[model samples]
Target: MKIEVRDVVKSYKHKTVLKNITFTMEGPKIIGFLGHNGAGKTTFLNLLAGLIATTDGTILVNGDNVFNTPSTLRDICFIAESGNFQEEMTIAQALKANSFFYPKWDEQLAQRLLQVFALNPKEKVRSLSKGMVSALGIITGFASNAAITIFDEPYIGLDVAARSMFYDLLIDQQIDNPRLYILSTHLIDEASELFEEIFILQEGQLLLQKTTDEWHKHIVAVKGNATDVAAAIVDLEIIDQHMFMQEMTAIVHTGGHPIEGYNVTLESVSLQDMLVYLSKQKARSGK
Candidate 1:
């Protein structure tokens, strides 16, 4: 699967959600779509699914305009935080409806997932709890098997055990039939292991796009006496930093070079921490 977003701009009245954003997603890979609230992650995903149009530029899926091409829309499946299925439909009915929308829909997988999620196919959507509703969305998304599957904060009401089950199912699906999966959530630590590449959107612009491995390699975290820390980061690109009376901690982009002689203690930065600092850096720079 190939999705090209060229100079894409999305606006609402006087405010813009995305500005001159351009990126290409070539799959089968699990990708993390991350940003703080209102950073335009949802708008970008909507563009991919052709649920909304851009103010300017284009989003192309396999060389076809995503907004106007019916075939391209069929290749993408999107499950939102809540209310994806008709409230009046039974679980079985919703699955049957989805089978018509997604040409690649797998009834066998859908049935299997019902067992996996402990959902009764006969249960009515309106009578189900919020967690059950989310389970339904998960079932449909996985069963759709669309070329590009997107989940936008899709586990809102799911319990820890249920969310873990979803993650395992997702990993299993990738192992058996790898495809493009774009997920956006605040549960970074829980989902970090599944991401191959990540796109960070900050204030409606593309902040960074790099593999999970590359992020760790290039963004270094260190702590030491203030003087030593300053020396260590003098020539490096500082992402974020904090200072106490006699000590300091800082994150920097090392350009993948080893900080051989610095008297600082090297630390591991979590994915969520990395994103937080990266966005802060972007905001400070007014970019």
Candidate 2:
């Protein structure tokens, strides 16, 4: 399922949430949507899922407009931060409801995941714990087996072990069945490896889009004499710089210039650090 957003805009109560956003997503790969709070990530996801209408421009799934079009949405599954459950229904009823909507719904997988998460089908959603609710959302997302599956901060109230299990299950499912997966989360470091591509939003605008491998390519942390490191990075865009007792470290963008001697050491930048630096830069630029 290919998703294409062309010059889209969204607003609520005259407050603009997305501004002239445009991007295209190819199928059978995972994408990480990175942004700070109120960066329009939710708005964008909702637009793609057809949960809300775009104020301007257009969104298409496989060339089909999403809003009011069931065909386009049939293969798309969106699990938001809050999965609005039928308060009067039990977990079993909710599962049954989902099974009818998703053509590829897997009852066995859902039941297994529920068991793993220690959730009872007979329990009412209104009475479940926050973590349990999140677990149910995760299970729904994975078991739906939609062609395009999206999880918008689905692990919000989950613990470390539960979140780890969610990640593991997501990756395992993707390997077994390659599909389009878009994940919107603040836990970038925890889920970065699952992403084949990365998209960043800043203050209602699309900031960056690149393949995860290409995005991380040549990004290194070099430490050595402060002066030498500074000289070496004279023309490179430095993402971050820090100093220790006798050595200084600079996090440079891809293709950083090499410095002679001074014990330069290259390292991979964590996704969390990448997100923090990107957000800081956006804030500094007044975006």
Q: Which predicted model would earn the best lDDT?
A: 1
TM-score, each model? 0.92, 0.86
Residue lDDT tens for model 1, 199-283: 9888899877889888888777889998888988888877789987777999887888888797899887888897788667667
Model 2 vs. true fold: TM = 0.86
Q: Which candidate leads in TM-score? A: 1
Rate residue 76 of model 1 by lDDT: 92
Off by over 4 Å in 2: 218-252, 255-266, 282-287
lDDT of candidate 2 over 47-85, digit per residue (tens): 888888999999988888899689778798999989557
- RMSD each, Å: 2.2, 2.9
Least accurate 10 contiguous residues by lDDT in model 1: 278-287
The Cα RMSD in angstroms, rounded to one decimal, for candidate 2 relative to the true structure is 2.9
